[model samples]
Target: MSFDDFYHAHFRGLVVQLRAYTGDVAQAQDLVQEAFCRVFARWDQVSRYDDPLAWTRRVAWNLAHNRWRRLRTARAWLLRQREAHVAGPGPDRVALEAALAVLPARQRRAVILHYLADLSIAEIAAQEQVAEGTVKSWLHRARAALAAALRDTTEEAQDA
Candidate 1:
């Protein structure tokens, strides 16, 4: 088959497969287009192969994988750079930390475990060597104290 005929026959199917694999239509189209360009460059030999479509499909998939790997590396580098540029915690976090400090030690530990650390009540109970009910009570009381403290801070700011 002519290169033009071969491309027309397989381009959409290849694009669809690449799109499903890559989750990006534009990227899929570009990969498929580049794959066809490569195949056309060597069509004299490729057209004689047992399965030109398979060869084209494999080329497109390889292009997609290479692109994904490059993007993943770039994203990791960006995230590391972003970590360095991150700003310090703001006033609300400061106020919340101060409010947390005023909680009794056990209550503070329980609150930090259950909420900040995302531990379950039963897990906190096991960690703290206390009953689940005690952890629950500490969480309830700590939440109330934090609410009251933050509210007071907000009120003081308004008054000032």
Candidate 2:
């Protein structure tokens, strides 16, 4: 079967399978698309396989598994950071809140969405109706501003 025919026939089923595996439709769709790209790149040899669709599914599953692993690693690192911060003298909550309040609305929103809501950059971009790069820029500026404000607050407290 031609690649186009195979893709049309199997795309939906692959997405469904990946969704079941990943438990997130967006991630499943991404994995399936990535698998398709890989297959398309090597279609000459891939088509010779007895079960090209099976090959595609295997690649998609592997991609999903790798994504899961990376997410787990990230979560663990975040947890470690949280623990380390908790063990130390953290910034004053009142000062942190004040710093956040002083930020521009867009910067505050971007920070809250990414850190508090644990949203991905792509998710934040979609929700904010802005490009991912815009979201990133907002986050960068917000972090810098917050850090400077917090540092000033710390120095004031030390002087007092």
lDDT of each: 0.93, 0.93
TM-score of every candidate: 0.53, 0.54
lDDT of 1 at 119: 98
Model 2, global lDDT? 0.93
- What is the RMSD of candidate 1? 14.3
> Tens digits of per-residue lDDT for model 2 on 1-160?
8889988999899999999988989889999999999999999999999999999999999999999999999999988777444454455877888999999999999999999999999999999999999999999999999999999999999999
Clashing residue pairs found in predicted model 2: none
Look at candidate 1 and tell me the lDDT of residue 131: 97
Which residue pairs collide in model 1, if any? none
